[model samples]
Structure formats: structure tokens, C-alpha cells
Target: MATEAPQRSQLSLRPLERDGFTARVLRSLTAFIQTADLKPGDRLPTERTLAAQLGVSRSTIREALQTWQAMGVVQIRKGSGTYLARDVRATSLHVPVTINLERQAVLDSLELRRAIETDAARLAARRGRSEDVERMRVALEEMEAAYAEHGFAIRQDRAFHEAMFTASRNPLYLQIFQQVINRISDAFNESRENPFVTEPYADESQPDHRRLYEAVACRDEAGAVAAVTRIIDFVESTLRHDE
Candidate 1:
């Protein structure tokens, strides 16, 4: 008898909460695209399937999908299915990314991240609110907790940086930085075992985070600058060989 072909696994989906329905749905769809290697004219799963998979109502899925379709991330097909529209580079939502092993790419992304985040820290220190400071603290706590429990803590780390950027209160800064950070995260994860999963690297990162936390908490602009610089330097030296 001929052997059957291996079954392809469905793409994993992140859980969706009611509070941030739109953002959650959009993010999920984007993740699906990334995982499935979706291109223009690719038909996505039906609304019923999406609703069930996302744990949201069909109406909510329709609403979010429609919003993306309008934004040009997706094209709704009358009878076939929803298709991810053409080249998404310009129109699709950008997320923050991490360094890749490719020397040139890693250096380029690192420079962009450093430029964006260093300035964000400066702005946050200069004009952040008590609430913003509190958010940073919470994010830090989440990171520490995740680190102790999970082998890695990218999500919380991402959250902390994002909160810091938000504290800057510069919409443009936050938006662009988020885009780079999210995409870089994939590269970062692919190389995590090489750079981050080991001994000294993991141990050393905490002190850097501590310094950044202190700087932001005190709203010390110079200190924030110095702290962020140190953190970025660590990332470049340890994770990136090209820079």
C-alpha cells in the first residue's frame, strides 16, 4: 500500500479577549498570514471557523475582518472565502521585530530598534505620567514572573518596551517602533537558543533591565539614556555578531 501524505497542521491562534476585540482579531489574522505564508488571493478560513477558533462571535469576526478588508489587508470573496489581498508590505500593520542571524539584516534592524527605543526612553523620562510609570512597573513584574516560570519571556519583555514607548506619548514613535519590534521578535526567537538560552547571557540581562526600570521610574532623562544605551549595547554584542 502507498503511504499517505503527512497532514499539515493548522496554524496556531492566540486567544482573543472581549475588551480588545478588534486589535486581537487583527493580530490573529496577521499571525495566521505569517504562519500560513499567505499571499495575495489566498482564501482564509470561513467566518464560522474563525469565530470558533478565535472564541468570539461571528459578528465580531465579521466586524474585525471587514475593518481589515477596508484597510486592504484582506479581500472578501463573495462565494469562495476571504482572501488576503495583494502585497502587504505597505498596507499591512507592522509589528516590532528582532535581530536575524543574517549579519546585515541583524545590524540594520538593531540600528533601527536602537534609534527608535533610545529616543522613546528619553521622551518617556521627560514627560511620562504616574500611570505610565505604573504600567512599566507592571510590565516588568510580568517579565520577571514569566522568566522564572517559562524558559523565555519575550511577550512580557515586548510589553515592557511597548509600554515605555507608549509612555513617550508620541503616536508616530509608538507605531513605527511596534512594527519593527514585532517582526524582529521572530528572528530573535529563532536565535534565542543560540544567544539567550545560555548561562551568562540570561543572567546578565536582568541587571540591564533593572537599570532601565530604575531610570524610567525616576524619570531621569540622562539615566534613562544611559540605561537604554547599555541595554542596546548588550543586545548587539551578545545576540548580534554583525554589529
Candidate 2:
């Protein structure tokens, strides 16, 4: 009897629910963009088809597309349906190779080159056509001429690698490899102690270059891998010694 009965309060806890419709629709559209490798001017599926695929209403899909269009991520065509915007960004190209000069970065990049390019060169040798072989030969010739005349053969070097990648017959690989090499070449040139204007690469580099070219010309896969690896290793060693 000392205290009045305590008042009892009832509390109800409800589990949190996430919005499903918009998020799912957006994710579905994003995945389609990536999987199709859709470039600018590529048309997306009709609203009906997209809605069916996403298991949502057409309104929801339309809403998502509208949001993307507002963000300049996609474009809507009059009576022509929706198309990807002109500014779709490819991640690899835009990514910056910073100047942290991390030891791991160099090692990793080299490792990637060795893993992919060794096989690329091997393929170039085994399957390359006469035109490809001739192209490589021309590149080497130009490189030699540059050596003798100017000591630097920037264009020639790029041409040789481009020919090798073309020989691989894999377009995706060729595109990415070319980009990587281009960046590396820029860095390598910048890091050189003596420009082509001053000191040319040692004569030994010519023979190694010739060896690689011949391997592709002759369709000698193993020889091509060996030649490429040897040439790259030599360059790396020389650079390290200079450093």
C-alpha cells in the first residue's frame, strides 16, 4: 500500500525498412551501362523492357532515368528513346598515376606489363601477319635511324609496341596495353639522364630490339617472349643503376 501502482507504458519497436524501388532501379540501369560497355550514343532498353527486367513498374524506371538525365549521366531523345550521354567516363584512363613514387607502384606496373605483354608478344609472333611483321620492321628501322641521328626515337618506340599489340589480335588488350605503355613511356622519357639530343642508348639495345622484331617476323612465340623480357629487363636495370 506504500506506493500507488506504477503507471505502465507500452512501447512498440518497428524494424527499419529501406526504400527498395528507386535504389534497385538505379542499380539495374548502372549495371547495364557497365556490362554492355555502352559508349556515348548507345541506346538503352525501352522503359517497358527495363521495368520488366528490374521487376519494377515502368514509372520507377522512368524516374530513375529522369534522375540520371538531370545529373547529365544520360540523355533522352525525342521519339528516339534514351541514349547514353556523351560524357560517360572510363575509369582506367581518368585515374591518375600520382607522383608518390611508391616502390610498390613501379613494381606492380612492371609486374602487370610482364604478365600481359609477354603473352601479347608471344601471340604477335605466332599469329601476326605479313603486314604486322613489316610494320614492326619499319618501326625498328626508324628507331635505329633515330639512334644514329638524334639518340632518341620516341615515335619509333611507340610504333614498335603498337605493332606488337596489333599482332595480338585482341582489341581490348590492345587498347589497355597501349594506354599503359604510353604513360610509362612518358615517365621513362622524363626520367632519362641524357636526352636523345645528348646521349643515345647503348648499341646493345639495338640488337635486343632486332631480336624481338625478328621473333615476331618469324612467328617464334617463345623467342618473342624471351626477347621482350630481356629488353625490358635491360632497360629497368640500366635505369636503376642510373638512379
lDDT of 2 at 44: 82
Leading candidate by lDDT: 1
CA lDDT, candidate 1, residue 156? 82
Q: Which residue pairs overlap in candidate 2's backbone?
A: none
Candidates' TM-scores? 0.58, 0.57
lDDT of all predictions, in order shown?
Answer: 0.73, 0.67
The candidate scoring highest on TM-score is 1
lDDT per residue (tens digit) for residues 1-243 in model 2? 595533212211122223566545555556556655667888888888776656667887787676567445678987999998854444423222222234345545566667778889988988899988888888888888987887667678767877888888865556556545544555555553422223435465677789999899888898999998987786566555555
Candidate 2 is scored at a TM of 0.57
Q: Which stretches of candidate 2 lie over 4 Å from their true place?
A: 1-104, 188-202
RMSD values, in order shown: 14.5, 16.0
lDDT of 1: 0.73
